[model samples]
Structures are given as C-alpha cells and as structure tokens.
Target: MSRWLLCLILVLGLTGCQSSAATNPKLPYAAWYLGFLAPNYMEVWLERADISDINGLIFPRAMGGVVAMGQPESLSATARGWPKRIGSGKGRSMTGLDLPYVVSLRWQSMVEPQTYHAAFLIPDWARRKMVESLPADCPVSGRTSDYRKDLTIGLAPGGVVKVWIMGPCLDPIEVLTLQAEIEPKGPYGGKSGGKYRPLSPVVKAYVDKYGVPYGSWWAPIPYTTVGP
Candidate 1:
C-alpha cells in the first residue's frame, strides 16, 4: 500500500480499538430504595463484602439509617430523590461470584432482638445488559431514551425480606426472598411499650389485597444498585 494509505488504515484501526475499550462492560449502576414494615423503625445498613465486621462502616448510622417507614413507593416524588448510581466491584462470596455488598437489618421485639442479613452479587449476564443500556449523549437526543434502573428492598415483620430490580425498559426481577419467622409481637402489635403504629399505607394496601406470604432465602440478590 502507498505511504498515505497505510497511515490511514493504521489510524482507523486505532480508532476502532479505542471505541471498543470505551464501551467495555462496566460495573452496573442503579438507585437503591430501602424500607422496613414493622411497627417501629428498623435500622438498616450496607457494607463492603470483604470489610472486617469489626471495622466496616455503615450507611446513615444507626440513628439515621434507612428506616422501616413502609414499602418504598416507586412512582412517588421520594423515589426520584433516593440514593442513586452506587458503584460496586468488591469482595467475592462463597460461591465465587462478585460479591458487591452485604445488607444487614436489625429490629427489636417485645422480648428479644431480631435480625436479617443478605448479600448482593453481580453475574456476567447483568454486566452485558448494563453495557447495552448505555445511552447516546447527543444534545438533541436528551435522556428520554436512557434506560433507568432501581433496586428496591422491603423488610416485613418477622424478618421477611424481598428484593426486586425494577425499571421502565425491563420487567421487574425478583432477586431475593427471606422466609418469615414466627416471633413474639413487637411494639407495633402493642406487645411492649404500649405504643403502636400501623404499617405504612402502601404496605397496608398490599396486605389488604393479598395476605402476607411465607418465603425463604432462595437466591443471592444480584446487586444492580445500593446506597452511596
């Protein structure tokens, strides 16, 4: 090939490589919504998977944690303002998967303390979908076409927990479920302090429509998102 023709080919090859590198799959991102369903507030926290329990930091602290306010409302104004775009590539779980973070929940009962714990993992397939969801940034295109992601966690009475990945472009994915435990009534049931608060309206509506169901830890949740 002529000198100028060869240089042109090399330049084009470099451009293609750069494009591929820029688009390589990255850690997925999503907003995290957390809520508890008991009569009194619950304390919740997230920690790096490998962090020593003796030294790991917890989000929001105990007094300012993600409280058990009720079921998180996705369409409400509060939804948009929840913590967003948490980046994760942390420790590994026992199964050799990429363990991003561990979720810890604690609450009190009339006679004893209760707890629920779980971890979030990322799989190969989710990484691919995250890459595909990347949107173009043209001044005219705007962000309307962008794919939004949300990871919602709900903890009910008796340590029952449910997690789901929800977004406009994809159907909701139920990632984790923890079975309910039979326990003494907490403050909510007027068993302890004689103070009572009903479950949040959203949670109550769901219970009214469909009674609480039993479940168990079936699968590790895939971490699409968590708090900052």
Candidate 2:
C-alpha cells in the first residue's frame, strides 16, 4: 500500500475516535457511566397527572428494548407524558399485563433509562362493559367522544394481548373502552376494525386499599416528580 494512503487512513481513524467521544458529551456523571453501560438503566421522573380524558396505559415492551409513549406532541417540551404509547412487539408479562390480540400501534421508540416521563393515553370511547372494570376510585364523569383510530397489524399474534396498569399512571375514563372487532388477514398489516382488549391490574394495591386522585386525558396530571 502507498505510504501516503496509509497515513491518510490513520488520520481518519483518529478523527473518528475523537468524534465518538462527543456523541454522549456533557452528560451527568452518573447518567454518562450508567447510560454508557445500559441506556435502559436510566430512570427519571414521570410527573403526576390528572387524565380526565384518558383511561389506560400499555407497555408493549419494557427493559432495554424499544418503547413508545405519548402521542406526536407528547414528547414536546410542554406535552403531558400521557401519550398514546405504541411498542414494536409484544412485551413480557408484568403482574397485570396479558400478551395477545393487540394491534394498531402508532409509534415505537426505545428507552434510554434516564429521568424521563412515560405518558399514558385514553381510548377515545369507554367500553360500557369496562366501566365497572375501571379503578373503583375512577370517577365516571366527562363528555363522551367517538372512539376513532387507524393502523396496521400482524397476521400471527405473539406476546401479551392486553397490558393493564398497576400504578398511578394517568388516563381518561371517558376514553376507556374494550377495543373493537379485529380481522387479521396477513403479516406486516391490517386495519383497526374497532378492536381492543380489557386491561387488568390497573392501579396498585395501595389505591385499592386507599383511594387516590382521579386523572384524566382531557386534563393533565399535576406536575409532581417521581424519583429514581
């Protein structure tokens, strides 16, 4: 190989090394090291909210994989973390989540384990059957709106079908519903023919023992920090 060509390659290699350092530049000491080790290890605050218009939260995947939360504006500076979260594939089971018959995911992203708020989204219409299923403390109050959405799906189902909440994550009671009819045709796509599954184990046991705040999608949960 030519000496000049070899020299050029060495210079480029050194520059690339320097550029890599700036990728995660200026991060907090802990966030840097921990995030460097495992981005999923990062944990931040999910501020409290009052989701008058929202009704449920679902995590299709957790741990170090992709995570989708909130809506288009949910990630914006002023957006309430209560977004219509969409996950890439079915996730592992939590105490309350059921993993099958899920569909029409809007967006999907991975978690970085830094302090960040995970938003919740309310189904546009509440299911009369699910009305009793909502948290006991959940107030049955709000103007009704049409349940509406569009999307694609898989030909074969995998993982938990429905994910229920077990914490104070916010959602709208009015928007809650047992999703509509589904007709899976083939892999890589399908339409939302009004299909959804019933969520279980929504609120933590503490709330069941002692009542807590009523959150809504029409409203934002109050700004309170939850710790690492």
List TM-score per model, in order: 0.35, 0.17
lDDT tens digits by residue: candidate 2, 55-137:
12222222232222222222222122232432222222222222111122321111211121222232323222222233333
Q: lDDT for every model?
A: 0.34, 0.22
Which number leads on TM-score? 1
Q: Tens digits of per-residue lDDT for model 1 on 1-228?
A: 235633533443343322212332233432222323232222222211121111122232212223434244442212111122221111112111111133433333211234333333333343233334644443554544433244345554445555554444444445556553432443333355644334446644554454443332233334434322
Model 2 ranges with Cα > 4 A deviation = 1-22, 30-194, 201-215, 220-228
Clashes of 2: 46
In candidate 1, which residue ranges exceed 4 Å CA deviation? 1-57, 60-100, 107-148, 156-158, 180-195, 198-228
**Whole-model lDDT, model 1:** 0.34
Q: Each model's RMSD to truth, in Å?
A: 17.6, 22.0
